[model samples]
Target: MPYVSMSALLAFVLVYGLGLGPIPFFIASEMFEVAPRPAGMAWGSLANWGGNFLVGMGFPTMRNVIGPYSFLLFSAFTMGLFLFTKFYFPETRGKTPTQVAQLCSRGLRSRPLTTATAKHIL
Candidate 1:
């Protein structure tokens, strides 16, 4: 039991440290070009901290109301975020901002551009 608990904690910490913790700071900058990057980053930071504040403030009341099932609520939240990211977030690492915006603007599912379309955008 202890080993399982410790392993789960370590796994979560590693995932958070490597992915969640750092991604927010840079992702907004990538999403926007020079003109609006600062505003985008500021808004993103505010949303991130606002969410943290809400979760911190609400978790205790939620736990009391939901009891052991409180974790289920958070699990559901995590799953929703996972699905949102997987479905809505574009792969921006190699894409230019224009390309990223075009890909994202298409809606729920994004498609790969053909050579002509890619050339037009890039």
Candidate 2:
């Protein structure tokens, strides 16, 4: 049980440090045009921290209700986030915020960002 807890802690740190952490802020600043970006980021930051608070505060009660099945719920939530990022989030790398906004406006099936079409986002 100690080994299992240690492994889970390490995994969380690795995953969050490598990917999950900072991504919301990065995306928030990258997704909107310059004019609205500050507002967008402020809102995004609020939502991001709000989400963390919800999960942190709710998990104990959630665990009490569902027991170990809480892990399954989180697994599904993580999968859904993965799918959303893979399919829907605008490709911000090498593309300007305006371009990203344009792509986002085009909906979920937007074209890939290429070097030829890309510009510095920040």
Measured over all alpha carbons after superposition, the RMSD of each candidate to the real structure, in angstroms, is: 7.5, 7.3
Q: Across residues 43-105, which tens digit of lDDT does each residue of candidate 1 receive?
A: 888887887789889989998899989989888988888656754687887888888767656
Worst 10 residues of 1 by lDDT: 104-113
TM-score top scorer = 2
C-alpha local distance difference test of each model: 0.77, 0.80
Could you tell me which 10 consecutive residues in candidate 2 have the lowest summed lDDT?
113-122
Off by over 4 Å in 1: 1-17, 105-122
Give candidate 2 regions above 4 Å deviation.
1-18, 107-122
Residue 75 lDDT, candidate 1, scale 0-100 = 83
Residue-by-residue lDDT tens digits, candidate 2, 45-106: 88878988998999999999999889898889988887668656766788876789898777
* Predicted structure 1: lDDT: 0.77
Model 2 clashing residue pairs (backbone): none
Clash pairs, candidate 1, are: none
